[model samples]
Target: MTFRSPFAIPRQLLTGTTSLGGRSAISTRLRCNQRGLATVVPPVTQDATGSKGPTAMVFMNMGGPSTTDEVEDFLSRLFADGDLIPLGRLQSYLGPLIARRRTSKIQKQYADIGGGSPIRKWSEYQCAEMCKLLDKMSPETAPHKPYVAFRYAAPLTETMYEQLFADGFGKGKGGRAVAFTQYPQYSCSTTGSSLNELWKWRNRLEGKRANGGSEPAGTIQWSVIDRWPSHSGLVEAFAQNIEAQLKTYPEEKRDEVVLLFSAHSLPMSVVNRGDPYPAEVAATVHAVMQRLRFKNPYRLCWQSQVGPSAWLGAQTSDTVQEYVKRGQTDLILVPIAFTSDHIETLYELDQEVIHEANNPGVKRAESLNGNPVFIQALADIAHDHLQKGELCSRQMTLRCQGCTSERCLGQKKFFAGQEQASMVI
Candidate 1:
């Protein structure tokens, strides 16, 4: 959760930088020892001018452990975040104790999924695929280099930024940077935390450079894709995934299969503070349901509740039990919030939740892991946003009126400022 380094280094450190090659050098200099992950050195490809394109696409999300030994560290880092646990000034003191207490249980869960989460692999693949798709679908940004940064694990945000800065990011020659949150729905605890961490790091580098330090001085044009809960392409992807999963049941039983949309739960304390996560989640579910022309019974439930605090619910387990009691045993549980297959989807839904259900007919939809349709949807969303060069379409950019978190509010103002800057130019 914490790293120590000065904000600036020598100008020679960044001279003659290229995309994948620059990253390999930075990784070597840092001596990255993350779960055997080496720098992904991409082959050189350039435009007609023989120069890499100016645009870079960065994807941000919560990272998972690649092995059993890292489970404790991942959870500890997650709990240590004040945005997640809200332990006030005592977070530093109590977070470690809490993580240690839960390690054994969480480790067991990770073991069920091959001793670690495959999230890193899946995310990296998604990044690589997106790079190819964007080049083909949005050639204006061709020669795009992709980077993935995690909030709680390796390939940490600061290191990814160092690679970008090395490649002349935020420098005029680099052209532009577009950051897209992998979380479909926005939450102060997740995407907000990642963005805040990024800016904090970027600011430190910039402040030091402004005072005649070594960080790159020319600023890159930056944009963000903050939230897209109801994006048409995304909605269609979910609808298609759910419909495909439901077809596994017999035709007659299919009508009886309840569509259970489940998302990771948030503490009510965060909700009462006007985080807007719950509402955004609902928006995604509603949009997906509408896309399916869903007439069958459906309900939104929460999963992955940790610690004994009130969480956003109708918990997924309790709901299944209640449905079983009512003799509605047929079900299709869709992980509406998650895009990748991780512990929450693989272990929680497949094993723990299913074990609690008395209905043998209950089934779950697979997470959208490397689905070509879904990946194309992601590409389409980014292509459109980049073409317009806006944070989002005005409709897609709407915020929760009740959200009062400074981070959420700041995102709104930041995008508005970008639009105004465009006007002045």
Candidate 2:
């Protein structure tokens, strides 16, 4: 599948700069414009006495459409991502066709969920709030700027990269930026694809020197918070939400209410590739269960498996149906993997599964959207990463056991080597 940029660059931005792989020259200009453009665009960094920041905290995720009108484009982009869907050699040909075919159905789903996904609203609010807390928690990284890089919607990775350049990041005046994945657990199809796209843009916009040396001096240095499946703050947030949901049950039946932790399912193809998602997701469930002291019976189930391919399951919908049929109708579904409300939770879980079960006792736990605890956890994670000064988690340096993609290898190497690169400067 091919990821084509939906936004175009003005001709002026392409004046005098190198292009990578004959792609475009605009990206290079965005970096090297320091020579003449620095005068017009003031740097975002602080003066000698202030905090060492204006740090960019970019949140990455697989975004959904914000409105019904955007559903088609969103699905088209999603289906076109080989990293996420992997449609083989005809990926380019089949992706758009499949997207067009499914657009109407998906659009209706989004319409039923209040005309669109609340992901963008929640994501923006969460990131902005997290940045506010970071400014107080980590003075060294104060003036934290929040940027959302959505894989399949508006404010795409390319757009975010351009904004960074426009905001005085990489025009030869080096600064720091952190790519924080919104997903609690890492998966090649999700976090990995986002990082790969980020890496691609970094190379295009901040490519090697015209003389074929290293990257230009003062280009933005990057670090990553790749994954944090079982962070204490995260577990606490989930446990609290589950407890609150449980309180709704009758006093006598509270303990009998089943806690079903649901995460997006992966294609078995991906799972067999040794993707770390399933295991990490389970880690999060275990951590939250321990925090709750396992007061209620619980199980992990997968949801949102698209297409006909074999997917990892105990499919959430099926599980809910079976349990309710067996008279275990007091089930509280916890969207464990998603950070905010989207079509999956709003439409699938709420509108479809629970609605079909036709039982008022069957309900869903609240998402982490705008949850103070979850937002605090975000700040804590960022603060720790900034203080530790690691390029990325040690786990990020390793690839899946069955991986063979050159893109994955290169992306890993670039991020993993940032420690030495940052040190050299």
Candidate 3:
């Protein structure tokens, strides 16, 4: 019966563990810990009073649909970010307009999944499942501290912090926090956004007279696994989910069916800007493809495009149409964009794209809902990170080299002070 903030971000705490390996460029250059694998996070130590702060986890995500007459207003805020969106000025006027126009359709789609999105509900489930799995997978830390912070929606960064503060949770016992991101992959937009928000929140907190955040409360000891796209257990979970979903399909048609892997669309601009989201999707798609016993080949596509700017690849809508034209009656759409079935998966795949190229065979593969395998994978990934100590290896961040984003709490700083001086004013 506890209510928490919708906004949650990752806090970088000094990991007490070591990082290992030097394979992927992302992992090699910037690991959760620069040294080696194997982090040593001290078990949660309880104190004298009745207040024992819990170990917390926050999932940084592109949140589900906002339930507001002002849903358009929410969309505008997303598209209006000067750094993320190319059309900031236009977004001020056009964002809400476009979002409002699409509201009914989107709203109806949400209705299909119930009155609201299943993200928070699923996340909470996953949290409980994660705890269960952790208890089984890593008995040493039987019940880890975890929390969810949605980027948008009612629970926001400001609100989560308020709850945390009121709960007697002040970064660690005295002043440190072992923060984690649920996503196994690290991309500028995904991992990066989470990191950025954390910094912003920390800075915002530092500015408040109520909580002087300047001093190290528990060093925001940052340990993030980033993205576990390559994790074998997770890949296996996908294989299992895909297998279970295909149950309704005729066994012989499995080969005939096309596996469409659809991820949330990112701006090609992020790639241009050095965010590795596309690569992350590529890795997930490839890994899943390898794991599936697909007699039928698959295609990797992107969907749910926002903003007026050019996005990364073939839109899911177009893909659907093309698949229909190609005479493929059966198709399975896999949304690896999110681990669970949220608004994007519900509305975009279930509603918008479903109608695009209506075919008798089109169906979306279920997202990773607390399925036992997938849930187990979550714990395995966490265990792996704990084994490796640090979540990522550090590489030189050009943005952070000389940047001065006081509120930017990322270990890999993106803005050099020199670059922001002109913008800071």
Predictions in order: lDDT: 0.69, 0.80, 0.56
Per-residue alpha-carbon lDDT of candidate 3 for residues 340-378, written as tens digits (9 for 90 to 100): 886667656776677555665788877787677887777
Looking at candidate 3, what is the lDDT of residue 110?
Answer: 58
Candidates' TM-scores?
A: 0.82, 0.87, 0.74
lDDT of 1: 0.69
Q: How far off is residue 268 in model 3, in Å?
A: 2.0
Per-residue accuracy of model 2 over 171-229 as CA lDDT, tens digit each: 78778899999998999999999999899889877984433335678788889999999
Q: What lDDT would candidate 3 get against the real structure? A: 0.56
Rank list by lDDT: 2, 1, 3
Give per-residue lDDT, candidate 1, residue 286.
90
Q: How much is 162 displaced in model 2, in angstroms? A: 0.9
Query: Any runs in candidate 2 off by more than 4 Å, and if so which?
Result: 1-43, 46-51, 209-213, 418-425
Residue 375 in candidate 3, Cα distance off native in Å:
1.3
lDDT for each residue of candidate 1 in 1-425, tens digit (9 for 90 to 100)? 00000111122221211111011123511221234355553433223364336567878899888787886677667766766556555555555655676677777777877988888777777766777888988776776777778877667777777777665565334356777889988887887778777666666554423332233545555577877888887787788888888888888887778999999888898788667678889999998888778766899998766544577888887888888889888888999988899877787788767767846788888788878878887888788877886754353244444555565455444444444423211
The runs of at least 3 residues in candidate 1 whose Cα sits more than 4 Å from the true structure, single-residue gaps closed, are 1-39, 43-52, 168-173, 208-216, 391-425
